[model samples]
Target: MRVEEIMSTPVVVTREDTLVKHARDLITRKDVNAVPVLREDGEIAGIISVSDLAATHFDDKKVNDIMTKMVHVVLRNNRVVDAAAVMVKHNVHHLVVMEEGKVIGIVSSLDILKTMVD
Candidate 1:
């Protein structure tokens, strides 16, 4: 299977300037673990995960203040195993799936494990 074949699309995303509280609410309401951070140019800037929000005692921050600066990206057409390898190599839990330079989906470690099990 390809990354796109199993990746979750319509992923929850947040702006870099978005308030941390709002981002946190969205993530909580959506019941998602991570939200991809986007820049004004519509490019991925970073990623804000549940851990990022929980790491700080202050809630009055912005996405840019807490987001993981480095994001691992996988091509939509990449093999699932290749994407999993990227995650392992980078020690990341999730990867942004890009198609034509645009983020279209997200693949998590859980997704990979489910694929393997099923």
Candidate 2:
């Protein structure tokens, strides 16, 4: 399967200036593992995950202050196996899916497992 086939779409995202608490709330309400943090120009700046939030205590801090800046990404057309390899190589659980330089979706380790079980 390709990444686009199993990736979660219409991704929930947050802005750099968004409060950590708000981001946490959004993640919980959206039932997502992570969210891409966007810059003022709508460019992806970083990614924030549930682990990141749980490891910190800066509810009032900005997302930019805690988001992981070195985001790992995979093209939508990439194979699921390749995406999994990237995740394992980087020891990451999530990857932002991209198409034509634009954010399209997200893939998590759990998503890969679902594919295997199915």
Candidate 3:
């Protein structure tokens, strides 16, 4: 299947200037493990994952302070296996799904795991 087939749409996103605490709250409140950070131009700037927040001791840090700027992304039509490989190669758990340079969805490890399970 393609990445779009398994990716979660209507993903929650955060801005670069958003406080780390707010990012943490989004994760906790939405029960999501990560969120993509978008620039004002609607481009993917970075990604903030649970591990990113957990790694920092200071809660006052901004999302930009802890967000991973070297975000890996996959096109909607790319094979799900390709997305999984990127995650494995980078030791990341999520991949931002983009189309025409705009954020559209997110693919998580669990999503792939479920595909395997089913």
lDDT, candidates in the order shown: 0.91, 0.94, 0.91
Best by TM-score: 2
Error of 3 at 104 (Å): 0.4
Provide the clash count, candidate 2. Answer: 0
Best by lDDT: 2
- lDDT by residue (tens digit), candidate 3, 5-109: 999989999999888888999999999999999887778889999999999977788898889999888999999988889989999899998888788999999
Q: Write the per-residue lDDT of candidate 1 for residues 1-118, one digit (tens) a residue.
A: 9888899989889999999999989999999899899999999999999999999766788889989999999888899999988888989999998878788999999999999789
RMSD of each: 0.9, 0.7, 1.0
Please list all clashing residue pairs in model 3, or write none if there are none: none
Off by over 4 Å in 2: none
Instruction: Report the C-alpha displacement of residue 68, candidate 2, in angstroms.
Output: 0.5
- TM-score (C-alpha, index-matched) for candidate 1: 0.96
Give the per-residue lDDT digits (tens) of candidate 2, residues 1-118: 8999999999999999999999999999999989999899988999999998998898999999999999999999899999999999999999999887788999999999999999
Clashes of each: 0, 0, 0
Q: State the displacement of the C-alpha of residue 105, model 2, in Å, after optimal TM-score superposition.
A: 0.2
